[model samples]
Target: MGGNLQAEPGGIASFSISVRNTGNTVAQHKLTCASGHGWPVELGPSQSSTIDFEPLDILEFLPMQVRLRIPPVTNGSPPAGEVDMITCTVTSSNDPTFSHSEYANVTVSELKVFSTELFDLQGNPVGPEASALPITVETGETVNVSMSITNIGNIEIPLSVKLQSANTDWGMYLVYDGVIEYDRVTFNLLPGHSTTVQVTAIIPLSTFDGSQNAFSLTTRLDEVGTNQFITNGTNFLVGKLLGLSLESSGEKVQATVGAWSQYSLWLNNTGNGALNLNWSTAEPPPGWQFGIDSAPKSIDKLVSSEVSFGVIAPNLAAVGDIEQSIRVRVIGTYYNDSVEVFIDLELTVVPTLHFGLELAPETSVHDLPRETQGQIVVIINNLGNSPGGGNLSAIIVDGEGVEDPEWSLQYEHSFDELQPGEEISVIISVTPTADAGSGLRTVEITILGQADEGVIVTTSEVLSLGVTAESSTTAFDLSSIVSTEVFFSIVVLIPIILFVVVRRMRSSAKIYDDEGESLVAPGVHTSQENISERRAAALMEDVEKEDDVISGDISQFEIQAALVQSIGDLPPPGPAPLPTGLPPAGLPPVVLPPAVMPPAAAFSSSPATTAQDITVNIDDNAAQGGVIGSEQSSSEPMPEAGQQNVAIAGMPPVPPTGLPPGWSLEQWRHYGAEWLQRHSGK
Candidate 1:
């Protein structure tokens, strides 16, 4: 064991011992130590103790640290630095008393790496750790610090020390103790040597951090590196540090170009002493102005203060990031060293949006007409601001029973952008069916949104409409039908077609002359022979009165009336229809007088021949007597004194002769025989 230790009275010194197993086999050994103090010896400064080693691998060294404590001198105590023999014995576990002994030449000395004095720059003594150090100063102040380092080894060692600080302005240097030469130097001293050196460290200002980090001083020996004889450390931070920070500096501020804004800044002095700091703003945007809210002079340590500022952006500040900074610098010559704090003022510029969206109708409520479409105008106003663009559309509010295809709505409007206070108009057209009953109709108009405009559509509102039912008619409700072409084809066109067909059919029928040759009908020549042959053919056709009434033929009725008079004057068959205006064949109609003249008077020479020629007239006067009345005269000539005649049925008898001045005597017998025989069915 090799160690040189120092101890004060009633103190202890420590040393280490290495036990190497040189044998090839693994062995177990028991370690024991004995000293001449005649007390229990141990590896840890005890007078007597047992140290059992575990199984030792081959060629491995099992090292143990042993300590020696020296008691104060008594009547029988050894003097200081007197040699004490500490014999450490190791015995193999397999052999009894098979032991080996090693001796430790221990001096009764306390741990004394340095026995010199240490002083600070103010001539005050300093301690050995981060606890006791040179006095602290305020921020931005350079501090003078001095300390000494001693070489505790017997051989000479190279010495160097550095101040560990991140501050660029902090300075530190050292010099050999008790020498006027202040330049840095290293010396190799003789054995059992000791030397003193002085050191200086400059503390930086901005170090009042809560992360438990501070500027420190460490020493280094050239030969032994940083271990062994170079284990000197000192913490330069005293009670607190000078620090300044703005609480609101971490977040960004938003504004538009040409707009002014204000911000509240909080400054905190987290140090233990009074502080003096000077701050300024730098790199502001062009044409912009900046001002402090409430600037104070200084701050006491550990105290927090508040400050406010206003920044007015220029009318030409570009729309992007504006790089700016706030610098807080401090210098202290009293308690804490110098500090410099910087916070960036990142100004983000954007466009101001003050647009307004609304949907207003021309009227509050719309009253729609039945069976027709209605329209309303909606006003869309662009109460604009800086700049933005959006779209506007209309939405119909769905009401109960309003889901029919007959009810419809339509509209679409879009404005890319508008000037300040610009106005726009839109129209919403609504259509209702004919069957739309009396009720209310609701529609909603809304402003639609475009992509990335940041405009929410809150302009939806309902538009109500009152409707009325249609009038009652025999017409059918064809609202569910596709069209009205089918109704016109059946109701109107077919009736017109039937009237044309009946008029054409009546014009094609033949009409006969049957007014006993006095009144001639149409479709006859003026020749009497042609008239007689046509008349005979018309009579032989057997005209029926039912045919006249059913076929709506007026000329057919005249034919039936003439056949009735041929039997006898039977009151002209109850007024047969006479063709008026133009005839059905487009001929001029013939008009007859109220009486018929006695025919053949001019044609026959005697009254008997005229009486035989007397025939019933096919006119209204034929219903009269021989003198234009219904009665027949008795003093009448027979049909040429021997001709046979048949009397008509439903006829009155003839009157006696000597009738009137205009009477024919033989005409009475003609009427009697014909009227009686026709009535008797002969």
Candidate 2:
């Protein structure tokens, strides 16, 4: 048998083989088939390795079918274009060399199969076939991957390669040989051949830690209507990134010498992970101190913590603005690297002055009498940051706003400089004169200082110092008399003196006209000269009767004396004759000796002329210049004793007494004249 057959992988190759009894007849023959490629071959329907045929059955040409199986690709199938031959043998059962053989050919066709593998640039397998593990990479790092694609098919094909990424912002590319292919690459591959491709992936810095991304390589035939063949992807894990920040609100700080100052700083974790941190500060200059508070050992992402730094300058540090540098270092608790921040701070020191003035508690006020001296104590303090220089002044001010020439105020206390927290006392001797008379006064005390900036600082306090009217040296001060008894005596004596003055005033008011007639009431019956003559004659008759009895009473003598004195002062009646045997009307009366007169006999006899016989007139000479009562004419008959004179026209009724209190004869005469004229009918 000679035949040709074709089969695909894992398919069957079938053909027919012919055998004839060309040898002597009636003998039995056996049939058998062998494959050249060691594949299984079957000869007949019995499916035995060898089959026997009879001579009668082989009389004519016998036809037999042979079947050959092609091997699968996974089981080591032959390559494309390879051929396999099958040989069938016919032999006599009894003879070993009496056989005839026939051959057939089997050809393998094209079979399409593919495989892929992945690895890093260092040849570490990281593909699906190798457990499909993910690749870990840090942010901002580049990764190179190798992709190997194998064609396990029986024929050649055009293949294309492409790289894909899960994120658009990630940079990915495909490469062939040594040249870069932007998105995809194409090439031809023979059966059972393999090719390598490079995949580049650039991780961006903005990627977050622990974020997952994927990159895949797709391989397919470059043919129309071909679906995507194979896609092998691997995950990219983003590693953790650590970040830190240190800052403050201000760089410069103010401080004074020998004083502690504190500053604040903010420490923040700005990265995408938690961190354990330690902080420290640099050493300070000589004689300066620096300190820092305990900081947090662990911090979470996006969290902030506050830290404090304290500093102090030495006592001898220079004044004015000074600068200092401070450095802060922060280190990770798990790492050795550190971050540093610097700050330049300023410290200020200047001279200042503050003054305080206070009066001593016990000596705040003084009660000084007139013509006496007193002392006032004032306390002054320098309440400032530095040394100060100034002067002190004091003055006495009267609350009543009265200035006295005899008042004196003197003090001698001054200083050129004074240190801080120092105090001093000053005495101001105040002497008030006798004329600086009484009431409240004040001692104004002031202290002034100058600062380094030429600014004035002053303080003042007002103290009360009273001046009493009492005098220490003067024995008797009339001005100091304030007794209730003396006041009452002065008030009672004033009315008695006023009464005497009023009586004398009335006596001086008498008036006489040119004819010696008193300027009395116009309707008066008597003239002033006639009344004087009647009074003188009546007084002389009383004295003569007393002399006949020779009364020794001193009261009678006093009466005679008073009569003598009163009549002697009156002007002599004008050109009138003297009554016979009587003394001249102007002559003074004779007074008997006191030894000859007896007190009991003086008032024993009652004279014919009583006090009622006498008539009196009152006058206000300053206003009217006339008396206010009536008088009898020289031709009128004399009224008898114990009888009143006849009532004249317009004359008022007179009192029984000679004169009323505070009334004079002239005033009574003028008034009586006017009264008689108005009441002439009555």
Candidate 3:
């Protein structure tokens, strides 16, 4: 059997045991102890024995023996102060055979005490001067704190380390623990080797701003089967926060009128920073105006600069200068500033009259008929700005260059303001006296102003007038009547004289033959004798018996022969008559019929000479009238005597006159034809 025992320092311990093999056998046995715990003992076969030990202040060792026994073996427990024990035996059961037995003994003792030393994962000794781990971190960042746990003591010891946060709200935590057990980690150290441990913590956004925030790290060490030890660290930070301005100006100057003028003003800026300004001017008022003289001035980066006219700073005071001037004598109130300030200049206002006139339907008349009326349109255009208040007087001069007091016409008008370029129209009617002579006439329009004491401004134009005499129907004097009668008597008598002479000449020519010998007055060559003879022949022809006459006393053939003989000569006499009943030579054939005579009583009072003379005078007058009116009037002469001839000629015969004063032959023919048709009808 073997045994183990424990004891405190300076302690004595003992143990006894008995072994018996009831079967008849022989046995062998041995005894042992651990190295530090010594034992003095012997063992015999089939025999049991007792062992004894003394506790040492230092650790001790012990060994055990094994035993063998025959059947029916027996055993016993170790004595007090033993930690453990073991025993063994072997034997034959049937007969008393050989047997063997072994046993072990152990002693308990106290270990020597020593101080512990710490080391890191690198196996480096961690002395009492070791410092806590340091860490730096930013906000919202996590940092890991790594540490090693080691045993620097000469004895075998179990150790452990722990990690924690001083500020729990700073997001501190443990990342790893080197100890596999609880606070009591099992470890053996030779005063050098070590194991690493790590702890981590997270920093949050709320940890800091533009200022510092702090946190702490804590670590603890634990001895095997003992209490804990602790250490700590601290960290801090600073924070920074992030910053943004916005500004403008107003307008100024103006101008007005009269003559020439000038004005000025300023522009200013009020803002956080300086500004660049650009400006220009619009066209100015009626007669006077203002303008920007030069370009716009600029200011630099600073609101105030010497280069500019004025400093424009934030809420700073500023002032500008304005110069104004004028040239003409201005009349109305002049405005100088935005606030009411008026100034008037010395000047004058004048009033005058300016006007013009035009005649409508422009024409001229040398002299107008008596009681003639004419229309005269006068356009009086006012060429001035002011109104013209005036009286108008029109005087008409006669055609004889004389002014008629009764021929004047006049009118008046009081006009309101006739603004620039305004006009008025007037129409005048005039009638001239019947006695107005023929020449130029004048109509003068005098415009007199009411305001100027009747001072006149005259404008005149001329019209020509023409006059002609009128005809009279009845009014006459005795002298004019007598003179006109005489003139008519002379005109009649001259033609009558001409006709008588022509008749006498024609009679003479007809009585003479082609040889210039009178047919009836044989050998008498005097024209007077020839006329007497023609009269005698005409009378003889008429005396032929009335019964012998055919187709009246004168036939158309005879009339034609007479006309031809009167103008020139007849054709030569024809051949002698044919046998039987032909006409005689040079005579037209006669056609006879039964003749009828007038009653003897009807013929009783008819004188043959009277009838013959009458017929002769008629024939002479007819032939002379036709030829004289046709030709030869100038050759005829007036008769101074011979009343019988004049009486026979009847009405003294119309004179062989030239054509009536203005009448032509063609006109005579027209009248003659009309007369013939009328007479023939009768």
lDDT winner: 2
Clashes of 1: 51
lDDT of 1 by residue, 1-682 (tens): 6555555445665677777777788878887877667533457433445777778888888787776666653432344466777778888886686778877666654222323334544445656554555344544445555545554433334555454543445555555655433334555543244555555554455545322223444555545333533333334443444556566766666544333466767777645566766667764656767766667767876577877766765543445666665443333323446565555566765544333444455543344565566665666544323444455554333334335455666666665654435666666667666555333445555454232354322223233444323443436544323233555566678899999999999999756455656434343223343345345545755455567545455564365444544534333446643422322222222222123222333223222211223233333343342322233333333223232222222222232222223424233222223232232331
TM-score against truth, every candidate: 0.22, 0.32, 0.19
Worst lDDT run of 10 residues, candidate 2, spans 589-598
TM-score of 1: 0.22
Off by over 4 Å in 2: 1-4, 9-12, 16-27, 36-65, 69-79, 94-98, 120-124, 127-131, 224-228, 240-682
What residue runs in model 1 are displaced by over 4 Å at the alpha carbon? 1-217, 222-355, 366-377, 385-390, 399-407, 415-417, 431-682
**Ranking of predictions according to lDDT:** 2, 1, 3
Model 2 agreement with the true structure over 1-682: per-residue lDDT tens digits: 5655888787888888766665555566788888888898877786655777756443566777788888876522477777998888888865677978877889997777777888853466775733576776678988777888887777777888888777879887887988888889999888767889988889999998788887778888787886748877788788754557778876564444444567788887654456787677777778777777777777875578898877665543454565556677776542553333344444454344565666666552344765567767777677555667766776665544434345676786576676777888777777777665444555666666655664323233234445343443556543233233555776778898999999999999956644333333343344344445445644564465545766566654344334433443343447423222222123121211112221222122222223223432222231232212222322433223334332222233333332233333333333332322232333
The candidate that wins on TM-score is: 2
| Candidate 3 residue spans exceeding 4 A from truth | 1-353, 359-377, 384-389, 401-410, 413-420, 427-444, 448-682
Comparing 1 and 2 by lDDT, which wins? 2
